[model samples]
Target: MPCDQDKLAIDDSRWQVAVAREAVIRPLINAGQLSPIDVATACRILGLRRSRLYALIEQYRSAPVTSSLAAARPGPKKGARRLAVEVEAAIEEAIRDKYLTRQKASVSTLHDHIRHLCRERGLDIPSWKAVRARVEQIDRFKLVRQREGNKAARDRLRPVPEEYRADHALQIVQIDHTRVDLFVVDTIYRLPIQRPWLTLAIDVASRIVVGFYLSLEAPSSASVALAIHHAVMPKAEWLLARGIELDWPVSGLPDIIHVDNAREFRARALARGAAEYGISLLHRPVATPHYGGHIERLIGTMMGAVHMLPGTTFSSISERGDYDPERHAVMTIEELERWLTLEIVGRYHNEVHSSLQMPPNAAWREALDRRRAPFRHPHDDQQFFYDFLPFEERSIRRDGVHIFGLRYWDDVLSPWAGRLDRQLRVKYDPRDLSCVFVEGPDGAHWPIRYADLRRPRITLGEHRLAQAALRQRGVRLTDEQLIFDTVEAQRELLETSASITKSARRQVARRARSLNAADQGAAAEVVAPGTKDEPETLPVLAVEEWS
Candidate 1:
């Protein structure tokens, strides 16, 4: 049929595209090469683009073989010619064995390595665009694995053999806290409330949660410390029942405690407790949830299992109670602890994990058996505590010290009034970022107020500058006078503008240095640094603002 005849017969304009499409597929059909499905797919892909081709094909279909459709203008050479075999080999080799290695290969790194190899072999290469095109042609880059089974398979596979022991199972345990919302009854308000707080510790090798606790409160330092105690210390009742003597200097104190910087986990008391237990605390970077993947994954599992419980909620009146939120509960703390110990933990240890192939309990027992000698628990009454909190050496300014260009202050810092210019270590909570604990050489810590820079307010330095401007105007300012009143008045008039002449001078100096370093070409392309968001303010007493 004629292409235009078929196009006219279809009332729906979209079907007209099929005429043009069929024209493109007609040549392959005449050659008796393509399958019926393949021709349809070709027509579907070509759609409107093949309209002219379809017309030409229909014209030639009824004519002699000499009336075959003319070939179009040639585009650039594609496919095999773009990607060379040599580049493909390197990328494949890098992925085969060293994929998870420390020096794993990346796309840019692969390109660089390929270029180096070409240079060594005395081959001239094309531009980076050409190299990328060539790499894509042969599927050299390992794109994201789209299969769900792949990640689960990777997780199930162990990096090393089970028998291989770095030491005891407890030598390097991982600890983390997660909030699990539970359906519980509120005794005070007589309503259902979301109760959250679940802290857990696992032996690194076996992946067994040796200690676990849950509550309707926010997790805190004491919660983590208690969890550790439950994992290491034999229960008093268990000791009494078995008639076994409890040993001291707990056997196999974890060498490292890996945890994310949750407020509860990053507390000074938690760090001190870990240090006392002879464990090195390792905290993950702020906001990076993937670092604590194991605990996070477990949280998902617990929520799936527990939150489905029927008819129990949190007590509403309990918020005003004297009890710490970190504590599990006053009335049911022991019962909850016992239930966790018996039900979730006990069942979890006995179940065979896909990763372990054997039960977690079996794997742990085997790991313990592989230990060269028996562990003797520590009996010493005294313990050493190391301050595991992160500290940065910073110079104090005003009543506040500038950390990362933001002001932080404490009312207790009045004693250090003279040492404002001196550098001191500022210890802070990596989690919340709300309170900074100021520490001295004696290792004493005092909690200080911390405000985010995003807050709308005048900084200490700006307030001082306003006070100075007002004092110069012969205004007798009282101690309680607002500093912003004087300073903000002439803020616009005091602003300094940048000059092109100064900028040119700096550019010239930079270029000269670049020339000295034999990087003249790079220096020419360099741009000057941008101005700060807020202008630099003169030094002032931070406490003065509060006064």
Candidate 2:
């Protein structure tokens, strides 16, 4: 049988194409310009059978070219389309409305619905196979997305080829925060703390990890600023401090930092500080995972490395079942910090990146060598530190400057004390509640310590937590009350163990950090030991802020 002789459905436009080919070849056969074998070859090209070729040739001699090329009318042409137009309309409507809405409905269900709908309309019905064929024509992507949701849509959208091309390093950088999937102990207490949070910055072009801040404290503006500060400055001092000899050449003020819409990223302090340095922040769209994928992948890599160490809270319950992370934990936060630094600078940087098919260090060096633009940093480290501190406007009262619930005073503030007309601008580090800086109308900043200097320093977070804890105990602490009680609260948490009570993980981490401080030296302020959560923000002010 020839291809044209075995006719397809009239609705299949290919049938008309076959008919047109026969029309074109019939004239050649009739004009005697072609021999029987030649005609047979032409019919073969036209997909006409030998018998069909002779029939079409005879029909073509008596009919117009247009008539010969037309496909025969399909269905019982004498009746109403083999089924009423209303019945076909009902089947189509059932497919779009009934079949598409169901997530797991089969074609048989669609066929039954079509017949049911046709019966209600008092119209003729088509075969179940005909209705099932209509199901095949449904657009799966659109149907699945409507029934299943964006996640289904997103899965199909992935494996998208890379259209992004890069010319320079830091053309765009992505940043994200993740709580490490591992439990680490305190250097002093040896008690496992909550998994530390890591704020990582990644350079897109070189696939270089610019810098990261790890803290026992939750994700906050201070940690982000600390990370960005390290990102923008020279790595020599940092690398030297870590006693690391490896070259970490990737450091510069990125023009833009892409991050999620976290409260930390939207912090006014970060915004103001970034604006000063001409760095803009772009917030990734909510629920859009791909936007921050670079840093996310880097985090996964870091976490994967950490999982090999003892105390890892391996990602899933199945992986972690019967495994005790706290009991198995060995490294302290600071040790992990150092270990992660070595991994990033030594292993991660030296290893080949998937995107560039070259080591990150090499890519960074290549970009730098190609363009020797001067590396930009703040003129002064202290100033860069100050620029990132959270600030607010407050009027100086006779009692001196009070923020939240604590009073800050310096004899230097004696002059500004009792002055109500002046709304002085004040900058504060939340990590320490012991002191604050007040911007005098004379363009000078006065450093004011807590009115009671004898008291041990505590962080604003610790202070707030203490006050809340005290309130729960029906005790209200006033400025006149012994401020040292708050410091005791800090110690109570730091000195306590979670081995028995299994206290809240965050509190356990807070306590461990405080103990580490005491071990290092019970200074007015204790600096957390740095970890892969790098850029350990030391206590410039008394008190401790846990990661």
Candidate 3:
């Protein structure tokens, strides 16, 4: 007879029996060498015939859950009801409005409510057993969420397995941030600064690295945006710009981006951008580290490879007893980035993954072959990149929009000027504050530059530093000119002291990164279509040989 697994309910005795059978059968199945003696012992322990025990083992092998092993009783279907349609409707309404509430009403209270409704409507009351069966049909997760709270439901009902699984590439991608275990020097001064943070995304199915972004700044919404942008866009031009000959073909929008409950991951910009591109953001339950095991393990593997470099901290202080990472740090941040790219594309992708039992590149290609369809790419690369930028809402005055004490104005702002009914959204890139993209009323982003075109471009970090310096001098009310002047003065100070002070050197490195981004943008404009250029090679850094 066909059984409805969804409606089936096993009593405590059957559930306990299933659990006992699972304890004996699971290990034998995992061993893969079941002997007659083993089967006989299991049958004796479970008090079942040989044929029955074999059937149960096959059932358990198909689905290792305890519920799969529960015996189905041959009787009226557990939730099959012969009641009138109106009576069923009343019971459902009562359960929803009265039983599933914060008041934590009991079954008897719910029965009374249903009795009153039935009496009012001139319908027969449902039996207590029928009402209880219907209540049991309610999803446990939803029931817990309604009676208890979200946190309690999440903690109690989350999947118990440690590994998160995906069937194909780009189905589930996990993103995370970690501080690199090696120190990198400033580009100009060649002095050690703090370790850069790396934001990485990995495809869970193939265990391939989709994209990564490294920055001297701590993890933030901007870093997450940039990392995701890199993951979605094609990497041919990016790789060419870095002079890498290796192929990194992993690029596309993931169906679900699994992340932890960090503030940056919960940012409005990320959530909205993901929704715009038809991507779902899945946040693991709070404090569940194993839920993100794939990304965490990838980070560990990358860090292990980093320890082979010249200035590695070796994961812990005890491991670095007599070594000095800062003094030995010879590679600049740019060099470190290039080295990491090489490691990811040239080495990591080609090596056999322990979990997949094949090279990640091989797994990716095989998955694509089976699907027989090309991966989805962004329709407009530039528009896709701009969509993830951090934004703010501001009203446009006759002069223009004001952001971070700087006035941005363009001819496009003339139509929406001095409008009090609504404020336009302005999106800015953290790497360059020279211009901001304003979303007009017509649902288009218009680029607006500084009102004073002669003013130089400054990074968001530099702008903040300038504001801090002005505050130190007790300048409460400052204009754009004052802010720019302070920024220029700070740049001069950093240049002069960069070689001696670590903080100054770090600031210089950050500024270099900002300028590098701008330079890349300019270079992309001059390059002809379908043409490649030889990028200038950076100086090679020393590395100790791995045994």
Count the clashes in each prediction: 15, 12, 0
TM, every model:
0.34, 0.61, 0.68
Q: Among these predicted structures, which one has the highest lDDT?
A: 3
Q: For model 2, what is the error of residue 33's alpha carbon versus the real structure, in angstroms, after optimal superposition?
A: 82
463-547 per-residue lDDT for model 1 (tens digits): 4455666678786633322443444454433322112233322222222222222221111122212322222223343553553
The TM-score between candidate 3 and the true structure equals 0.68
- Model 1 is weakest, by summed lDDT over 10 consecutive residues, at 1-10
Candidate 2 structure quality by residue, lDDT tens digits, 418-459: 764547778776655566777665434556777766655566
Q: What is the lDDT of residue 253 in candidate 3?
A: 76
The prediction achieving the highest TM-score against the true structure is 3
RMSD, one per candidate, in order: 29.5, 25.2, 18.0
Runs in model 2 deviating more than 4 A are 1-166, 370-373, 442-444, 475-477, 480-483, 493-547
Q: Is candidate 2 or candidate 3 better by lDDT?
A: 3
